[model samples]
Target: MKTGNKIKLFLVDDDAVFLKALQIQFMENDDFEVETFSTGELCIQNLNKKPDIVVLDYHLDGIVKNAINGMQTLDKIKETNAGIPVIMLSSQDKIEVAVSCMHHKAFDYVVKSETAFVRLQKVISNIFKYQKMEKELNWYMDRM
Candidate 1:
């Protein structure tokens, strides 16, 4: 993954309006290529595209009564590709929920707010920055 390339991101949310807003926010930046999905199943199916990050809504109660939630989706994604970063989002700010998401290897748990998009952008940047640092360290170690 070259830093020169735009980061491909997958955002899964059942809320149509919120999903659209997230897509718009991420797409506005030239550094990101955003893909939106209404269900976690759909997003997981498309992981073959190898997105850099995933933004998943905690509750995926679409038309499907048995739809998988964000934590379940996070587990599925981690099982597929542990390297990909997944950030869980929800309106509920319960500590147990956040802790559960973290236990499932979620990169971050964000509660929905008016400034959620702004915070998301920062999280994305931090992930990329940390990845860059890790890659650089590995390169140096290989040379050693």
Candidate 2:
């Protein structure tokens, strides 16, 4: 969780082109190791892979065949691992949607756009920084 360390990232999106593009963009950074999933189910199935973070889209096609949306997938993920950081990616700009995501314990939400990748990198970096600090703080407290 140190800065510049290789952080495993699992990215879930229904858009094939966007998934591939993001995989490439994230992999270009030495600090990131990216895996792309075209569906939330696929990502969930591979949750044992222990990715440091998950980037998930807010919408998906064919998920649950008829019932589930990305938010439901997010809920499932949190159910399985509440501490894992999740960053929601969506084109939706409504404040309610963002607030709902936060209420559900998402680490952050980003509107999908040309600059989304850049913003994602920054967010991940901050996550790592915070995690590192938390570890240090816990160690200090344990020694007290």
Candidate 3:
């Protein structure tokens, strides 16, 4: 996925307005190529596009009653490509929810708020930094 210069980002949320706003936020920056999906199923279907990161809504079934939720989506994504990073987004500020997301292998959990985008930016930055370090370490180990 890192083969491209710009990060490919998948934004999955049932809230049209919120999804559009978030898409606009990421699109304003040239660093990302953003793709928005209204449901987890749609996002999963398009996962073959190989997005570098996925920002998934915790309540993905808001529009479709039987649609898969964020946790399920995360698990499916991991099953398909464990290397892809998934950040779970939700209005739930509960510690348990965040912990559950972490347990389910979410790269991070973010609460939807005025400052959510700012926090997301920081989290994304950290993710890339960590990936870089990991890559470098692997390179060094390979030579040893």
Candidate 4:
């Protein structure tokens, strides 16, 4: 558990306005330390900061020509640190899109909507809970 520390969050989206809005909302909460990136490449480059979680847009190629999409970025993130949980964000409400993200090892998928922030908050809570449980389980197993 992070305890007294704020969660390090990486927010990536090509939509400047939307990105700023999301960043603002998260920044309002004292529990998050957020960094914004306009492209998946930039996010990848800054992986050294070691964000606890990443909220990545599904379509990152909107602005940059030939920019890598979210899936590619997700793959790179997983390759770097499989344990870091990534939550995919997209305007696409299709089940297939969500399933595809899950198949690619996304921790969760959030569709952009009126209630997106609430859903993202719940998912983040679950991730911490799961991580704590896993850590405890590992500790017990080591004792055995």
Candidate 5:
């Protein structure tokens, strides 16, 4: 999609306050159209809406009994549509968690903190830039 169009984003986190804050934060940006979900199941159920990107929390707790964690949710999402970019969010900064997220095809893994939203903005910008370049390359390839 082009920059002229608002990027559809799905924000999935078990924290009600955090989720709402994220939705509000993204709403300030003209480039984003945000949707908030509290659990992996809700996020998965709305996949038909086809968001351009998904911000999924690493641990989904308290929302449901045995709710899918971010990694499992990532797997399920990729199973349905591998192309959708996903940014995995967690409060922990462990190497193994980051590697696992990458293994599951997450676009990026980010640790939650005071600066998390700022970093997320940067990642989203990068994803858009990369996607634009991919589209241009595909268009060139089709011309050959």
Candidate 6:
């Protein structure tokens, strides 16, 4: 990918070890510019940076169940920038949770596992393709 096409990715998870691992993985890959946060609040605070994609954990510390969770974070993110795509991360394998994330407009959801990195790569590629098409469409509309 060209330098101008490199995607900015933000990862938010409460697990410090997981965050560090993901940071290292992305750093080794040239396609992504990765930033990580240990809390959803920190990620929200950095919205001005306009990251192209956000990877969010399903459960967060200090957030009440059935009230505020990753789904709530997803909503807040969309409120801030509706066009920004988000990928929900969860250890849960329940289909309901995955469906809920999709219903709430998550770009994709992946279960935490050894293959998580592979899934993330696929999601990033799809998001990039969608974003590129969106940008082109908007440009064409502007020329009309």
Which candidate has the top score in lDDT?
A: 4
Candidate 6 local lDDT, 66-110, one digit each (tens) = 435677789999999988899999999999999999999999999
Winner on TM-score between 4 and 6 is: 4
Q: What is the C-alpha lDDT of each candidate?
A: 0.91, 0.86, 0.93, 0.94, 0.91, 0.86
Which segments of model 4 are wrong by more than 4 Å? none
Q: How close is candidate 5 to the true structure, as a TM-score?
A: 0.93
Model 2 residue 60 CA deviation (Å) reads 1.3
Model 5 per-residue lDDT tens digits across residues 24-56: 888998888999989999999999999999999
- State in Å the error of residue 122, model 1: 0.5
- The digit string of per-residue lDDT tens for model 4 on 1-144 reads 368789999999998988998899999989999999999999999999999999999999889999999999999999999988999999999999999999999999999997988888899999999999999999999999
TM-score of each: 0.93, 0.90, 0.95, 0.97, 0.93, 0.86
Q: What is the per-residue lDDT of model 3 for residues 53-91, given as tens digits with 9 covering 90 to 100?
A: 999999898899999999999999999999999999999
**lDDT of candidate 5 at residue 30, scale 0 to 100:** 81
On TM-score, who's better, 2 or 5?
5
What's the CA error at residue 87 for candidate 6, in Å? 0.2
Q: Count the backbone clashes (under 3 Å) in each candidate.
A: 0, 0, 0, 0, 0, 0
lDDT of 4 at 144: 100
> For residue 144, what is the lDDT in candidate 5?
100
**Residue 140, candidate 3: C-alpha displacement in angstroms:** 1.8
RMSD of each: 1.7, 1.9, 1.7, 0.9, 1.5, 2.8
Question: Measured by TM-score, how close is model 1 to the native structure?
Answer: 0.93
Question: Cα deviation in Å at residue 75, candidate 4?
Answer: 0.2
| Steric clash pairs (candidate 6) | none
User: Candidate 1 or 4, higher TM-score?
Assistant: 4
Which residue ranges in model 6 land beyond 4 Å of their true spot?
1-5, 62-68, 135-144
Q: Which candidate number maximizes TM-score?
A: 4
True lDDT of residue 13, candidate 2: 89
